[model samples]
Target: MTHPEAHKSHRAGWLRAAVLGANDGIVSTASLIIGIATASATQEYILLAGIAGLVAGAMSMAAGEYVSVSSQADTENADLAIEKKALENDFESELDELTEIYQTRGLESGLAKQVAQQLMAHDALGAHAKDELGITDTTSAKPLQAAFYSAVTFTIGAALPLSLAWAIPGHLLVISVAVSSLFFLALLGGIAAKIGGASITAGALRVTVWGALAMSITAVVGNFFGVATQ
Candidate 1:
């Protein structure tokens, strides 16, 4: 019997975008609602603010993720281009570079050179790209994919608190949204950590703490502003 290993590193690109989007959506919208509700705003006004935050946050996440990932993609492309030219101009030097990389990774010199020769014979540019530049297909940047994930996850995350705000009433709205959003944040963190092969408890605690702090600070600010206005 042969065993195949499964790795989670391939999930890096989309997972990062999704986690960030969902986390931002929950924290920002929840904080916004909690702040407004704490200030004694009308339910309608609070819900309206939540909706606006959700829409704005989703768009911002999409655009920001797209642009940021696009930049990384551009950088990777530029590096690949330079590597390609270097290979075209100095095949021997590039071959030696790849061999040296494998040697440093613990292969004997002769074995390293042979391995490099075989890899380069099959695909010189690919060998150099993977070994020297650290660019692999699994880890390559995808702007559109990142943007889509971020936008969708953010909308879903923001809806949680917004719906809670709508369903709950009075001063209780603030407390309810705060508590529920923290739970959502913790759940999200744990899920992300689990998928990424990290400690779920640590992840959950990390996000929960930050979310609680965010809501608390927003509540204080809202209370202050509400008092000052009155």
Candidate 2:
């Protein structure tokens, strides 16, 4: 008996949402804390802002992912419904369409027709959904799953910087939170990339660069405002 090969494609749906959520959580919360601190806000105010950012960001990410993925799922279901109706109305035509699809993918016409016939007989809608509409169990949209992952991961990620801010006080709070947040971001990127079978270094660098930029810009704005107010 041959062992089945492991694949990462199945992780595509949740992984996208998780990585996006975590990255946003860390970057946004940390940036908010850093900006507040740079503006000479008290430690209490900085921590408060971090908490608010965490809660708001997590909810925003969850809502955004849910709505977007739900739209995709709706479109997919609509397509499948249309395909089902066509299959019901003209089974022979649908069979011929599948056969032509297989033929275009390199199978000989006769073999393609035979394969299509067998597949349609086994599970007509499934065969059409996969081959014709390009929707598979692994690749299909999942709004609830996406929303849950995003919300949970974002909360976890945002908690890191918030905890650091709470623990570290005084002038060092800004530097400590900034540095630690970058490390967290890099670690998250590497883990996500490794799991998805991509380049770890590239992924880590990609998130780190953007995180740093966001923090920098926010800091500048905060400092400008602080100076203007004074």
State TM-scores per candidate: 0.98, 0.98
Give lDDT per model, in order. Answer: 0.94, 0.94
What residue pairs clash in candidate 2, if any at all? none
Worst ten-residue run, lDDT, model 1? 170-179
lDDT of 1 at 31: 96
Clashing pairs in 1: none
Candidate 2 per-residue lDDT over residues 133-224, each given as its tens digit: 99999999999999999999999999999999999989898889889999999999999999999999999999999999999999899888
Write down the RMSD of all candidates, one decimal each.
Answer: 0.8, 0.8
Per-residue lDDT over 1-230 for candidate 1, one digit per residue giving the tens place of the 0 to 100 score:
97978789999999999999999999999999988887878999999999999999999999999999999999999999999999899999998999899999999999999999999999998998888989999999999999999999999999999999999988688878888999999999999999999999999999999999999999999999888888
Per-residue error (Å), model 1, residue 216: 0.4
